[model samples]
Target chain A: MDRPASFLDEALSLDDGDSNNLQPWIGRVVLVEDCVETNGAFVLHHLIKRFLSPNLSSSDSIVIFVAFAQPFSHYDRILLPLGDRQGEGVPSKEAKRDIGDMDWRDLVTGLELAWVGGLGFAELGCNLVVQRENKRLIFFDMLMLECPDDGVEDGIIALYGNIQKAVEAVSSLNKNITIMIDDISLLEVAANGSTKDVLDFMHYCHTLTTQFACTIITVIHEDIYSSADHFTLPLQMEHLADIKIKAEPLVTGLAADVHGQLTILNKGSSDGLGRWKSKIRNFHYRVKENSVEYFYPGGRT
Target chain B: MATNKGRTSSFSRNFSAAPTSSIPGLKYGPNGTIFLSSGVPDLDKILGGGFHLGSLVMIMEDTEAPHHMLLLRNFMSQGLVHNQPILYASPSTNPRAFLGTLPTMLVSKDDRSRNTDAEQKDLRIAWQYKKYLGENKPHIEERDGKVEYCNEFDLRKPIEKHLIMGNRVECISLLDCSSLAGFRNSCSKFLSQLPRYDGNITSAGRIAIQSLCAPQCEYFDKEWDMLSFIRSLKSMVRSSNAVAFLTFPASLVSPSVSKRWQHLADTLLSVKAIPDEDKELANLLTGYQDMLGLLSVHKVARFNTQVPVILDATTYSIKLQKRRSLVLECLNQAPVDGSSGSSYGTSGSCSGSSKTGTLDF
Candidate 1:
């Protein structure tokens, strides 16, 4: 409640930490898809910062990063706060609730979630290196996972086994565990273009979600499957994801002020009756040196 | 960008902790990454200090014209010039023979001086501001010795056979491979020998695979196989000190499949051939006659960083400077009678452009 809630937080309903299940993201599947023009990797980085950063007490969770896209140094560099000067996202100077042109309603879904002097700022991003050192983070560097020609599944099967073992080992700890796949398209590639193998791998990951109080987050290049099961890889993930976050370039074009827009499709979490109601949140975001600025259309300060 | 500084002292980034490499044809970039020139100096500058050492650069070749060959030839030639190991795979029966057509490095010293003289004579100082005003500073191609970071290649003069024969330049004909597996094996074998980045990269390698998904090759129809090949190639290249440049015809493959290839590319570019007698296009832009094609930079690789590089203008007119070395210039819209069209400054910095008519010369 002390930290200022970004539009991304509101979309994922992370702002309301105590209301829903102790942690909404736990026991859920989150899918992020992006195109060539706009990369959605920032979402994964934000998620890592959110769960790992000790400031967010309610959602303090361990992260299992199965990186198919980039190395640890990359995520590490990004997740580290943008030097001493900048704080986590909302600089107190910019957090002044009274920008003449902007309306308070436009800030956070018109839900009266005005900035209550969130001038109390803590810099965004946690030191990934320190987290990994403390054994709270498990990183699988699959950058060199080259499956053999003899059989497609040999390499990926072992990779899945390793992930399962890591998850099981971590699950024993009382903390909520979240498994993150940097991307799935690359997984398909590692599986020698076998969508079946990739799907099988995801199915296995789904089992972990059920067996443990775990959440699964994955990234897939939506543009690849944009036209058509609409790509079986994305199709399966779509079915699995409780929250789907799509990052796409602006409809008009690229701009310096606006990096891209993210659409968060929240397929509501199960209630006592197990009824599902999906809600969609669309907003524009600008990625900065230290933090990401999320605002509504026609509502930037 | 403060983010560039990370949480650490900004000095560590601008001034790299890693000792500068004495290698030729390499430039230091942010995040401890070294960049290899993409052959064409202008192209290199346009793509923000050329391609990163370990990244996948994919060029979507134009369906009607072989414009991508110009890029591929220059990429391989730059590696050869730098004595960097090269593994070139092509659909041709004799990929080595194609190296015979590699352009010779232009005598940069004399030609550059000559070019400056010509520019001073032909282009007035009034219009010369266009170079620095709206665009990134033109990279200083400082030639210290036999090795140059980037060289202006003379397309007319073929590189000496001695240069091609002496270096560790490899050429694999796609016709020889029945499956991508065999080709991937050779690629992996070649990439394995290249140096990797531990603290500092001693040497780097370049891999140029032309027409990777061409129908002439045996694995043309197998979309997933090609995708996996590129995926693995990207992965292999990422760990090693190498740059893998691959070109595939976007028109030849299905849209969805082409999208997959585009997704995998760290740097994605597409080249389109200009029609010979498109009257409207001729009127729309100046210097229509000299243009060979248009180069659109879809994506520029941002290694070890999350920020996306958005170029001022994605499209550029690929014109052969003096009909020799390739030069990419911003499109200059012709001055319509009453409307007074803006010229080369695509970001609407046309205000600074001289009223030297539409003929920017």
Candidate 2:
């Protein structure tokens, strides 16, 4: 008998013997809310790995990653096993052996990276992706591109058009596509803090999820927005998302056994018909050297 | 032959002659009503199915906290979606940032396929008709076998491709005016340049002025100039077929000056952040409290005869929900203890009673 091809299935199975009860994430919008005290990169990395894991039989599945806060090289290091080992200053020989023992290498094979904003990072991302075979890269540098004489509307239109083209190019594969926007706040800044424009852009992205049967994951830092006006966008997005996951550091110091908390609110079931009764779960997690461990709040119990 | 001649004369009289409608740019809604969409459907519902043509809408907001800008964005966004030309005059707002605030139109695969299929079918039918009519082509603008009134604008997508392809209507005009005179001049120039007709079909445009007096307060040497500017602006709006929105910073101006401006507008709306003490009281009374602000509709034109004045002067507690839609619940009655107690349990009952006692102030 064959196992189900879902990284969420495998990942949840490792959740302290509460495997069979866990629900799988199909095509949905997941919001990862991060605060100043907590870094959500590790959780995002884990999510990407789960989506790309070899256990998922769908080899054709694609991952479209839009980077704003970080460069391609930064993501490449976080995603690829080779880059991960190199970051650790491990010798090349041991890194090769470690790669064979894990599924991380196969997990990043289907990544398509996009860089928006300055050309410095986009160029760097392009070069990095080009070194690897079958990897796709797209870049939109506002500095180099001439905006319409009228103003930013033309530029925004161009940016959206490029994204549409990229999505269309991969549509033929008929695979489970996941579009991850690393940080929406950066995109808002790039758009000159126009809350409406950003919200509208996300609405279009939401449309794509239904039209193409794709999943979207967006990361937003709550700390960036202080005023009520600034807070509205994130609040609006939280309402729009199907799944809301908030990550914040524990009140105790980082040296404490439990480092942070991950609150997952499944807004609705997989079918979306069961929205009236949604489920919310919390887990205390710790980021180790090469992996992350999720445990109950007060030990295994 | 005698009957046919009579019919021909009647057809020519109706078709060949100019349209005698008094309003030049009147757009008929889905319900065949002469109303313009406020962008947010909920708002449109509240304002008696949208703003009446040639009426001025004035939004007053706290000078320190100008959150009413979001409503203005929604108004402008609706205009763009309907392909209505917008004349945006502001001194502080960045054009790029303003453009960025528009929401994109959702385009599904089915819609794309259906649109293309429909276009091709329309072309074939038009060609056959043209062959039958022979030489007397209609005055309508035809492209790819279909007649279009004006280019449709989709905020959800990038417009560069449409611009590059040509024939897309330039819809937005951003004017950066520093002085009162400059603002008036820009408004006149922008309004004059707007197209009155889209191939014989009447079309309307939107004029939005951000903080009418803020710029004047900074640049104008006298307050009378600001008052005169508002007077001219009111007359201009009344004369033209365009719907105008003017926002004022309440904190910057005196009560009497704002009252005068409010009197000039057809519809007057004020949005203010709830005070901290009231918010805490509300939270204590209601277990789940997220309402952030209060919106008051001081006056509404055209509803003076049809609807009661009391209904027009209602207050709504504004709650921005998770779905991004602004929910405005009418604040009709004072908060009572019993209802709050049942929803919040024992602790809620205790706090609710205390809050109600303090409500006498």
Candidate 3:
């Protein structure tokens, strides 16, 4: 069975087709940079659901979610609103009313696509808890991580060791792995802005991609260092990523129909067909309770 | 806007629809979040609900004016009225004395007609629906003689001594704490008293820290230490059933540190003092003279959901009603001219007040 692609999937050149054996996004470092006025967390949520959804990748895949921003409860409820199962670890639930299914043509027509992101989580409803229980998802709650002045490197090294151990366990099972960090900026804050130690952690993570062919995705706020003369962290992150997705508040401002605009700059990515040429596409998105609707500018009435 | 109708409808229903306790000062909001009043009635309305329990509410202070005190006063007073534990920290040595200046609840409504209307509504539901009064009907109602959750305060009047003496109001001087670490220790000691229940709350506490990075404090120059303190404070407050209200002068600290504080705040707001005499602002909007300052909402805390609350208007002119109690009103265009959107440019000369109050953009 062949599934059509949304504008976002095409923008990132991620194929959802059935015949694809090798994943297109493996061994790539994808960076999502956002500003203060608009948070890029929704993009991270979208990517989480994308990797966990079986249609987009192999069923034997694992997603290592390291969240330094919000707790597991925040990401847990985004999967599906199992209000009846509220007794579980997650306290709150997503609003269930926005889970109506949609056809892929809705994405192309630039219509105000309904609340559901219309792809993975909408139909399959992959519960993060279930995924974690079945060994398909790994969540590390880092909200309470406060590194000391001298032990900054030690703390990051501990985290890197944990991730490497998890990667090792999954690799032997012939499972593809994706290590996702909700944000790297908070990582800096936890380290008290020790850039060198944070850079070391990134270098080690980069080595993991070469070692196991695991993909890594990170998010950082570009505006934080926009005025800095050196621009070390954001510049280093931009240079490291194979593809960059930037979410920005509209120059005009926020709107009811459109939450913010996302610009995807895709470097050449290899696939079953061939390496797609580097392309750039800008689209608008509206975040909903269960999913985020992506549409082109002026696509909706 | 049209597509969001269903989401918005469900949003409001989720607030009142949940089975919540008749906690005096606590109301159940969406996403399993309980709202504790920010002390100001109009502000509670502008923020959809008041500050959620466990949220770090940061106010970017106007360096030239003590406008942020208006918010701090109401916040402390509301907690005293509700009998919630309050731990207030200020840079001044006489932090305890500041509690005497807290505003008391306005018992008398100057608007007689509105007073009678509220009485009739509460009286109608006294026997039948008193127990079923949802959290949505947030008013000072005497249905079963239950204590009101939120109160309107008379800014001119100092709180009654009994109200201040009877409650668990703890005040600490920042001078007592040499560094932010010491200050953080005081916060943790105070927060340790009010533990949180899983999806259930016994009582909510209020922590108000005034001018956290003011020059007088010893840790004023320790920017990284202050940032780390805030970061630790954020994680601490998130686990307990309390709201930490901190105000810092954005102009005093470096811009990068200020930006980090904004990001850490669950609900971020900035207050800018209006000019004493601005002819351009006077001509551009109605009620220019009554406007005390402008409050712009930078962010609203989103708990479990990813959807952000995009308000129709972000900035509102802070005004006082009859110069007695605090009131917030959305600034409207002056009735003098029926000009279209093109005229916005001509009036917007100053950067602070340039934002058209009601315009969403």
Instruction: Output the TM-score of candidate 3.
Output: 0.84
Question: What is the per-candidate TM-score for chain B?
Answer: 0.84, 0.62, 0.82
Mind giving the per-residue lDDT tens digits that candidate 3 earns over B151-196? 8888999999999999999988987778777778888988998855
Model 2 chain B: ten consecutive residues of lowest lDDT? B141-150
- Which fraction of the native contacts appears in each prediction? 0.52, 0.00, 0.46
Which scores better on DockQ, 1 or 2?
A: 1
Candidate 2 chain A minimal-lDDT segment of 10 residues: A111-120
Q: List the residue pairs that clash in candidate 2.
A: A157-B158, A157-B159, A196-B101, A197-B100, A197-B101, A239-B322, B104-B155, B104-B156, B105-B156
Candidate 2 share of real interface contacts: 0.00
What TM-scores do the predictions have?
0.84, 0.38, 0.84
Instruction: Kindly report the root-mean-square deviation of model 3 from the true structure over all alpha carbons.
Output: 8.6
> Tens digits of per-residue lDDT for model 3 on A1-301?
1111256776777744532333777798999998778888877876776676655336577899888888776676555531111122222232222223322211211121122223222333456766787788999888877787888746888999999999998888877899999788788888878878888898899888989998899998777786766388888888888889999989878866688999999886555588577889998987866456788888853
Model 3 has a clash total of 0
* Regions of candidate 1 where Cα sits further than 4 Å from its true position: A1-5, A17-22, A58-60, A82-124, A146-153, A229-231, A270-278, B1-21, B108-147, B197-199, B341-361
Candidate 1 docking category? acceptable
Model-by-model lDDT, in order? 0.75, 0.52, 0.74
Q: Model 2, range B1-361, lDDT digits (tens) per residue?
A: 2443334234433432333243332323211124566665445545554676556788898666655776776676666655667777665445444655554433342455357547745644633453344321211111221112112223334433332223222222223434566667766666676654333334677888777666434553344446556655655654455778888886566544454455456677888776656655464434225666667776554310111122322456666543344445444333464443222112223443545545544
DockQ of each: 0.27, 0.01, 0.29
Give the range of the ten consecutive residues with the poorest summed lDDT in model 1 chain B. Answer: B137-146
